[model samples]
Target: MKKIWAPWRMEYILHVDDSVKCIFCEKKQYVLKETQHAMVMLNLFPYNPGHLMVAPKRHVANLEDLTDEELKEIMALTQKSVKVLKEIANPDGFNIGINIGRVAGAGFEGHIHIHVVPRWNGDTNFMPIIGETKVIPEGIEKTFKKLKPYFE
Candidate 1:
């Protein structure tokens, strides 16, 4: 049997604790950039390399709950994230969207955030298509360091 190794996910698998604080709320320490209404941070489990999320600081579950200001700020920060990704990773393309509820694949259903995933021409392969696994080239801390300066 072939094994797909993504040892980072072990934390989520082993700690199954429901008492953990809301990610968007408790993620202040992990924030790369912040505006009054929103923040940008690296996704702990990414769909692709340099995948990051833009989340409203207000902690609303549904996108409809976002204030006009929050909406504007989230979009603005997303654009900035793209710029940072371009400069740091030079990805060929991008995929940006939000998952509002659990059925929509939101791991954190209580917070609304936009996922900005950087993509390259051959980034997708049988590893994901057949094996159902994603391969991230760099560690999150490395990605965080590479992206941190741009937000500052």
Candidate 2:
């Protein structure tokens, strides 16, 4: 069996800080775009090169808790995210979803957020299937920089 080396992930594995309960509540430096009620930010651990998350500014765990304005802004931001990614990343398709609970695959179970994953033709390959690893061609910081200008 061949091994995939990802030394960068060690930082996430070793640093276990329980104090910061909700990641969405914190002031994010890498927020790509924001409205009065919602914001979009790059995923620190992305599924693809241009993966992003859109969420309501208020700390709401469920979709039912969102106000009409919040819901509108969140969906607007999600749409904008896809548009921007298409321009910059030129993805063939997208996977946009919101995992409501932990069982539904939400890493931040208490915060409702939508994930926008950009996909290209033949992006899924042997690495993820056989090696159990996902290879991101670009660095997160680099990708953040590429997408930041369009949002601004």
lDDT of each: 0.82, 0.84
* C-alpha root-mean-square deviation, each candidate: 4.8, 4.9
Clashing pairs in 2: none
> By TM-score, who's the top model here?
2
Look at candidate 1 and tell me the lDDT of residue 56. Answer: 92
In order, how many clashes per candidate? 0, 0
**How well does each candidate superpose onto the true structure, as a TM-score?**
0.85, 0.86
User: What does the lDDT read for residue 83 in candidate 2?
Assistant: 91
Candidate 1 residue lDDT tens string, 25-126: 974555899899999988887878788999999978987889999999999999999998998899999989997876666777788899999989988677
